[model samples]
Target chain A: MRAIILEQVDRLLAAQSGAAALRRLEAGEWPEELWEALEGLGLPLLLVPEELGGIGLGWADAAAVWQVIGRYAAPAPVAECMLANGLAAAAGIEPRGGFSSFGQTAPFGRFAAQLLLEPAPGRLALHAPGAATPGQNIAREPRDAMTPGPLLAEGALPNSHGPRALRLGHALLRAALIAGAVEHALALAVDWANTRKQFGRALAKFQAIQQQLAVVASEAAAVSVAVSAAARAVDSRGLEGASFEIACAKVVAGEAAQTTAATVHQVFAAIGITEDHELHHTTRRLWSWRDEGGSERAWAGEIGRNTLAQGGAALWPDITARDIS
Target chain B: MRFELPSLPGGSAGLRAELRAFLAEAGRDWTPAVRARSWMGFDREFSRELGARGWIGMVWPKAYGGHERSGLERVVVLEELLAVGAPVGAHWIGDRQSGPLILRRGTEEQRRKILPGIASGKLAFCIGLSEPEAGSDLAALRTKAERVPGGWKLNGRKIWTTNAHLSDWMIALVRTSPAPEGGSRHAGLSQLLVDLRLSGISIRPIRDLLGEESFNEVTFDDVLLPEDALLGQEGAGWAQATEELALERSGPERYLSSLPALTAGVDALRDVPGADVAVGRMVARLNTLRGMSLSVAGMLEAGEAPAQEAALVKDAGNDFEQRLPEQIRALLEPEDMPEDLRALLADLTQLAPTFSLRGGTREILRGIIARELGLR
Candidate 1:
């Protein structure tokens, strides 16, 4: 099932999504056809329950999808809508999803029909977007400030699932996306190193280039493992239960994003910094997404504070406690 | 490359609890300084006790006196021991690589004779791969084992042989024959299980920068080894030894060597204002590396030789281990910190350089990774 889903997503992205489409989206042109195709696949309702007229997939499945989306640097808020719809269902609000976005500060807010807002700790309120002040991230994706019109639904989040739940969800998704993007960037760098000639030889022929790519590969591999483990944790345990793994995933992915971006850009040299190159499509997303959900520094601080509070003896146990085996 | 999330058998909580209880009691008297040594702390009695509990050789078959447990179970035991800084050096090599190698490639009599001792933690082993002239380029080793009347005659010097002075046996990679004309340098190598107590063998301990004599330089002069001492097929040692090195590189030890420093730092800086961020970052990296290590172990259990993946893990893991102590040091104020924490920091600061050097140097591991990436 995962293989099929990932294959289809990869095929669609390969066929429809490209640098030109991304550039159009960034230029304030809506991805109407792409969004419709993704909607037809029921991607936005990925985490909604099967009984609720949506395909109920586990977090692990969502992680794989998010990674593909990131690999293509998808211009739509498919991941955001999927999570928001899932959150709405969990909050007992029936999904009437045209397009949904979730956050304390929503992304693609103007485009989303419903905005799932964490009005306060332990409270979730669904609202409709009224007017928006257009904003954008470094990747030029919409980060519009929405003036919410009227509340659609309001409910209290369960004690086990509070603000941290939303935070972990966002961080986990971003980490998954960054994992895919960085890996794609690595592939780009490897291809560039192999093809581009310098000093009468391929870049990859040089030990220095090989060594740098090796580090990029290592960082990319680590982020991939970290997010996979985090997704599995979420599948087995809820947000609070998998908080440590999720936090670690976010930190690892964020750190890898920086390292991989820097190395790949260096491998590409001057041409990579230009907008026309395919590398920036992924690298720019890496720079933006890493700071979007939660920065590595923020998550690391949380993990460190919690670890310290637990004391030295508990540190090992805390790390190993998530082991299902 | 994608690492599939490894799934372990259920009921690990019970195993972890049992190991934790045992380590807490056994390690009660160990100070921060002692725990900092972790795997380098060799204790025969401690190993025997663990073996008695069926922890050593947990993944080997029972015919060789093993417990026949799962690989994940062994991972649990190792991490538990290393996490608490248990002295596991006495049986680490035998259980981790040699015994496994023997089980895979040794003769029936050899397995029967050697594996039981290793499983029981009664016999200790050390690798004899590196020589004075063959540190990173092991193929350049000049160690020769000439065919004798009834056995082989060994004559060579092996340096950086960890536990050589204390171990009962050494698995030495030797030049069995000259490379064929214009052929591979790795062609004529063979591994021999040599008895350390042999008459022609001499062991001299080499003190490291930390004043620890955990490694040794072993010299062999016309030593006689029985025909059965040849482990696996002759002239296949390069492949076999590379496999062993992969095993050596992938385990929790790659990343957990500096854990004691981090743990001690956590204790000392528990109430410090802004220390959590650094500690948290280290913990995050440690946790991620552990996941990757476990994934590799899963690959091993599934009958895949993830040598390249293991090299990548060790490369990244060693970086984390080396940086951990320096990060902790940056957070510490020596005059205000606990003496034990300060001492552990000092010890780990000296020990950090070896973390990347011992298994395989960072450069060599990266070179391997580059080859795996098809770069040359």
Candidate 2:
């Protein structure tokens, strides 16, 4: 945990120089150039297995990168790209070059060489101009809503082409999202408390507010711990066991994100909610990311129901260090 | 009466086998949904069946319709119930604490009146200690009941009254006097058994974010109950409330609510080559928690007060419960899933936010633990 945290700190230190772009992101500006530079620096492919000539990091490592990404509030698709590539690498496949994903909204042509979408039917070939090829140019939404578009294209590919990388990589990305959002929210909150004056005293002096901030700190750290455990599960136990840890990871970490963001807004008050503040960017992104993969309650009911069916104990097998070893 | 239960008694294995046979029949052909009660919904009949099997109120003496089981023996029964998600919700409160409370304090007549039904699984109870104005602050309650002829006329309201509408009786707290000039007003509060059938009493369910109708806005208006309704002494409600809170805060239920989702999560990976090892790690932590909780129960059974330990266990368990939903979601649908699963996952994930808040928010719990540790 300490090593991973230190690695994250190093990542943050490297990105510290990108502070100016972070400010622009707060103003709803998508610094595509800076993001492009980050991708060039291999920050986007941080979770691609080392076997794939990538960083070969786990959920915790991805979380560390995301923490750095969060500090700058970078309006880049790093998490999105990592999610796409991580699973492909895991499944012994490699997806090279630029691909933008079509999730909730369509991402138009901006900085991508290709479009990434879930599998579609042959109907596109029957209807569209790129019908002769295996794929067609399609536009989709950028991960960060604030990103500006270059152009739009409407086309689709065959149903067989959906990227497998997103399957496993998505969890890592979501955890990164939570970790990033929490760090940024904490930063925004701590800054406000330190500088903002209330009743001729800093807000930090109030016990009520102090207690609230401490809770935020503890929750974020706890989620971070849970996510680290999930990464360990995947690394040690492989995919089958990793799912259980992931359940715990998403629920706890997601709540940490939601609670931290909500509390950050409350602690900062009017200033935090405004478009001009960094808090808005982190909070809004958190809202979008929380629903992207799955919600916490869905997982709880699932975990509990599954335990009941077992008619014994929960799914803790006799895992030893040698298992992962 | 400190009842010592061996960690791995010879009877335990035999009892487990017997319970399996009994539950297989009692729970025969029961729908899977009914078996997994905490997630699907609560059932009363199943609990009654368990009661008939002497499972409910298993710890009390046989004279009270109980099985007079030891602590370890009772633990086996409870572990099976929770592990299988038996619809024990109806009898959960009654069996866990209400039966014990009645046995400890109620007059012989009151005990006979309630314990038999409770042991028979005919009664459901909810605690009405929280009010809209008073949540974490239990002693600050203003719901007052004055001296009247046949009984005391009640007039205050309680919020977050879980299953109050379905419950036959509510063990509630009300202020018997003015705030008492800040000299530890906790002593002036009193507890009463308000039968839900009274016409003057009203229970309006409070709709929560989850759209679950578990909470009720219980209103008391000129409700009269016989003075024999008072449990213990008038000035003793505070102590009683503390003891009840400790009981409430302790137990496997605190951590086990998310067991179903966790099970589903592990199940999805069962066919995978490496799931066993991962499941083992998760299970180890859960077992560790369960062990701690059981040890606390053992302490409680030994006549040792373990409020701080209970609070710690509850908060830690809830913290884990709150994490289960999101982590599972990430595992199940690491990326964007199909539209329907996504919708279902969204609801479950949203449901995780309140686990910490429902029992006792993390803050209040931390405060309790801190006070226990003498850190305050």
Candidate 3:
């Protein structure tokens, strides 16, 4: 079932969300068709329960789908809507028909009918999207600062640390996306290395290029594993319970995004620096997405401080406790 | 190329707790410098105790004196031991690769003779792969063995043979026949089980940068081995040894070498400024590496030879292990640092270079990954 879902999503995104679509998105054109196609697959409600009039899926499944979204650099707020819809269902708020963005600075906020926000520590408020100060990230994805007009619904969150948990969830989403984008970039770089000839041989035939690509592959693998593990942790344990894994995921993904982007760009050389090539679509997103989800430095600081407070003896036990059967 | 996270089976928590408790009690007298040795800290008594408790060879069948535990169970035991920098060197190679290799490819007599002893921690084994001339290009090894009437006469020199002087036996990869002209250089190589006490065999310890003589240069001059000493099929040593390396490279030890330094630094830098961020970065990297390592272990458990994935883990893991001490050093105020932490930091910094050099070098591992990427 997971493979089927991933396959369908991969196929759809490959066809509909290519370089032309990305260029359109960067030019401030909404990917209405691509968004509708994704919605047709019931992706927007990916995390909502079946009883809530949506297909119920776990974070692991969501992670796999998000990877596909990242693979094509899909210019739609599919992940955001999925997360926001799930949060609405969890809070017993009626799922809106149109897009629903999460947090104040959600992508495509102007297009969303509702915004899910943590107004208080344990309270979740669904507000109608009001006036927006439109913004764009490095990849030109909408990061609008939407002002909440009026509260439509409010309810208690399932866990304490609601705001922090929601932030971590956002971080996990970006980590998954970064994992996918970095992987895609790696693929492009490898393909280019094999295709482009220089000095009467392919770039991949050179030891220096091979070594750099090897590091890129290593980084890609590390982030992929980190994000998957984090998703599994969230599946078995709640966001609060899986905080450690989520933080690690964000950190690892963020770090890998930097390393992978730099090396892959280097591998693509002058062609990569031009907008005509497809590598920038992924690398720019990697740069933007890495800092969006708390950054590696932020999470690393938290992990370090927490581990220090627990002292040396508790470090190993803390790491061991994360492994669930 | 995607690593699926493996779920540890039930009872892993209990197993980890038990191992942690044992390590705590057993390692009470160990100093910071001693723990800094990581897996290189050798203690026969500790290995024996772990064997008695069925911590060693947890994944092998019970008939071979193993506990018939799961591979994930074994990973839990190993990570627990390595996390605390326990002295597991005495039985490390035997439990990790040699015994498992023997069980998989050895004759019945060989398995019966060697495995139980390894599981009981009464026997120690060292690998004789790197010769004075051959380091990463293992096919360049010239260690030769000639067939005799009823045994083989081994004549060769093996360098960087860890624990060779203290081990009871050495699993030596030797040239059973000259490489066929214009043919594969890997052909005609074979593995032989050589007793260290054999006549005309000599071992000389070489001190490392950390001032420890844990590895040795071993020379065999016409050492006689019984005909049954052949570990696996003759002329299959290259494949066997490379397979053994995948197992060796994909363990917690690959990433946990500098963990003690991080831990010690964390304890001393609690009141220091900006320490939490540095410590947290290390912790994050450690957690991710553990996840990758565990996934590889799961692949091994399922009988999958994830050699490429293992090389990726080792290369990234080596980077983390090597950088940890330097990162910790950058975070510390040298004058305000505790003496124990200072000494450990110094030792780890010196030992950091060996992390990438051992098992496989950084360049070799990347080459393997590049090959997997179809770049070679």
Alpha-carbon runs more than 4 Å astray in model 1: A155-159
Cα-lDDT of candidate 1: 0.87
Instruction: Assess each prediction's global lDDT (C-alpha) against the native.
Output: 0.87, 0.61, 0.87
lDDT of 2 by residue, B111-215 (tens): 888888888888988887889889887677889989888888889899987788788998888987666665887867888888899888989988877677877
Interface RMSD of 3: 0.9
TM-scores for every predicted model: 0.98, 0.54, 0.98
DockQ category of candidate 1: high
What DockQ, on C-alphas, does every prediction get? 0.80, 0.02, 0.84
Strongest candidate by DockQ: 3
The reply for model 3, stretches above 4 Å from the true place, is none
| lDDT of predicted model 3 | 0.87
Interface RMSD of 1: 1.0
Task: Give per-residue CA lDDT, model 1, range B166-185, as digits (tens).
Answer: 99999999999998889999
| Deviation from native of the Cα of residue A80 in model 3, angstroms | 1.0
The residue pairs found clashing in candidate 3 are A304-B280
Per-residue lDDT tens digits for candidate 1, residues A1-325, read: 7788789888888889989998998888878998899988888888888888778898889998999998888668898888888777777777885888876467888788888887887677888877778888999888988888799998766665656567878999999999889878988888898999999999989999999999999988888888888888877777677888888999999899999999999999999999799889889899999998889999999999999988987898877877865
